[model samples]
Target: MEKNAPCTTVCPTKALKQDEVTRVVTHSTDLCIGCWACSMVCNYGVIGRQKEARVAVKCDLCPGREIPACVEACPTNALVFLEVKKLSGVKRTEAALKLARGMQGKAL
Candidate 1:
């Protein structure tokens, strides 16, 4: 788990926890206090409020399913599930390509 993650850090009831084996962050509604701190601190803004339950809600990556429903339902395939390292590598490759294209017009 990211030690500096604001959502997890600010959760007063410790409802958010990262599984050591799966490395998935899990939320325990039973422990949640309806404070919305997790939703407020979520970087991706995926967290939401369960209006009926008065508790915070977020994606659990669709446990027991091979692919998350969101990813499967995206018609344009805009959403992708990838490991952090793989995503970082893809970003780095894109940046390098952009740099190379920009340098093509320069004297150097």
Candidate 2:
């Protein structure tokens, strides 16, 4: 969650916004015009077009909830919410762990 998100900065309708304190990016369908500007500018591809509604759609941080629905509802704990600054470290750690594990093959 960049302080100045590309999607929010590129949006003509100001539909996408980033919180200065939390650094959480939010998408507002009410203000969205379905212009696809956010979708195009978003590097993560989280923003998408809702063809039926003719508006952009993205996670709004679950509004009143502490955690997003997808993160909370994930049965396999696949999805996780993290601060932007910590994301790189997390990815690095995951890569290191995978590299260390490698291919075990058969244990004869």
User: Candidate 1: misplaced stretches above 4 Å?
Assistant: 1-6, 40-46, 49-54
lDDT of each: 0.83, 0.84
TM-score of 2: 0.80
lDDT score for residue 85 of model 2: 61
* Per-residue accuracy of model 1 over 1-108 as CA lDDT, tens digit each: 343557877899999887767767788899998999899888768679998898888789999988899999999999988876787799899999999998997986
Candidate 2 residue pairs that clash? none
lDDT (Cα, 0-100) at 31 in candidate 1: 95
Which residues of candidate 2, in runs, are more than 4 Å off? Answer: 103-108
Instruction: Output the TM-score of candidate 1.
Output: 0.69
